[model samples]
Target: MSAPRMITVWGRANSVNVMKVLWLLDELAIPFERIEAGGEFGRTRDPDYAAMNPNATVPTLVMPHGYTLWESHAILRYLCRTQPGGNAFYPEAPEARADVERWMDWTLASLNDPMRIIFWALVRTPEAERDMAAVAKARDAAARLWSIVDAQLEGRPYLAGECSIADMAMGGFLHRWFSLPVERPELPNLAAWYARLKTRLPYATRVAVPLS
Candidate 1:
């Protein structure tokens, strides 16, 4: 198969899910166009976007040959595996690839699942519109989730042992956790891991945007 030439991403800039896909493109040095559609944009509900993705979510990818795809993490893995030298992130061996792929799956299935509420409540919600009680509850839940990932990071450089798509994908949410004004415990390991990620060019320029 030949290398994909043109790819397009659809989603808002601030969406963490969308941010992950965008960051992946940056990592692969893949050039693409992005059109804002979800959140305040309202195009997600339109028939055109819905036809592309029935779920009507952000970070949908339009492949070179017009194959449309959705789900943020899926898009990242596809780009990593399909693009030239996909092995760097996805790897060539099953154990190594699965090591990275499992965490990418975990991010969508586990880590990111709990973080949605806290992110929306803290960053997206307006001051007057905010619910302190719910935000606090979500914050506590999110902290526990971070602890799980932190535990996984005991001595490893990143999830699944390398800076794969999992790192870039989960890094989007982790960036929010560190940057937001919410109070959190002194998770030294997680903090250390984050310090290393923040130094990356993509994390510094894209994933490391202002929290609110």
Candidate 2:
């Protein structure tokens, strides 16, 4: 009999999408191998890496059986379906699962672009090279979007009423949004939620790293 192949994740550690997957794996205690790719590591454009992820994106997941999956959110859903102790975060019930999924989708659709703009402007660009106008625009956009999240989190400890993939999806940006050297509106609930996420070891270690 052949030895089993371990699941592999290809992405750089600083990627928020990659961090989400890693945090969940740790939360579920699933062991997997990680290979550095994307960003400064720069394997993403290579033909071999492109074959695995045609988008040449960070976080291409290769399952133990040799199945390949791309897109971070899809990988998160697949892991929740296949791994033990996953249903707790991604629930089996249709409506309940949708609730969790809604925020994940929302994070990608509404929150991602503005946050990316803000991060690249403030973190990646040097102070002299910074585009303060663009940064201010993105900052305002992010604040408006985050206000919706703040309202949703008013009576809930986590999005979707429990610590789900929704939180994991948005968690990394929470770290960045708060950590960035920019003024922010007082969203008390969002602040509190961020504090809650900080208490989790997996979140702190995986998602809350210094912005690169």
Candidate 3:
């Protein structure tokens, strides 16, 4: 058998994107070395770092044999495809996998915009400097989107009916949503699904932390 590959992840712990990869890595039982490199850590702009990821984004993956990859969702998909137990988390069936991909795409295409507004306002921006009006509007928008997810979870435990990449993608943002101080409309199903995810050690320790 070939020697196990060494995987190194570059990004700060508090980043939602990085947390997605970390949570999935833990679930896959993959060992990796993580280097702090974004937010206050601030090495993403360095020439060497930029060479690996021109976008200067966090959560860049440095694989064995010098392969490099960036973009959080892309990294999540790549790792799932190459590592053992990949199919368990990222099914191979066209329809089943598409179900997972749709949610993951929804997170990026739909949910993230409003969610980021709320996250930045409440978590990143100081109270004295917050734009409360903007925050409120964004919160409302995000809540509506989450309600759709709540309805999706009405009779299922995971986003795609079975634990898969969809859950990993959304769980990172879900952790932020429930943790934020803003009032949320009743989303019991979403709350319960989050509660179930909390039972997982990775979600408990990594994803479900104080907002940055």
Model 3 residue 86 CA deviation in Å: 1.0
Candidate with best lDDT: 2
The residue pairs in collision within model 1 are none
**TM-score to native of every candidate shown:** 0.91, 0.96, 0.96
lDDT of 1 by residue, 8-28 (tens): 888988888888888778777
Alpha-carbon lDDT, every model: 0.81, 0.92, 0.90
Please write out the lDDT profile of model 3 over residues 33-67, one tens digit for every residue. 89899889999999989989998889999987788
Please list all clashing residue pairs in model 3, or write none if there are none: none
Residue-level lDDT tens digits of model 2 in 1-212: 12238888999999999999999999999999899999899999998888888898989999877789898999999999999999989988899999999999999999999999999988888889988898889999999999999999999999999899999999999999999988999999999999999999999999988889
C-alpha RMSD by candidate, in order = 3.0, 2.0, 2.7
- Model 1 residue 114 CA deviation (Å) reads 3.4
Which portions of model 3 miss their true places by more than 4 Å?
A: 1-5
Candidate number that wins on lDDT, 2 or 3:
2
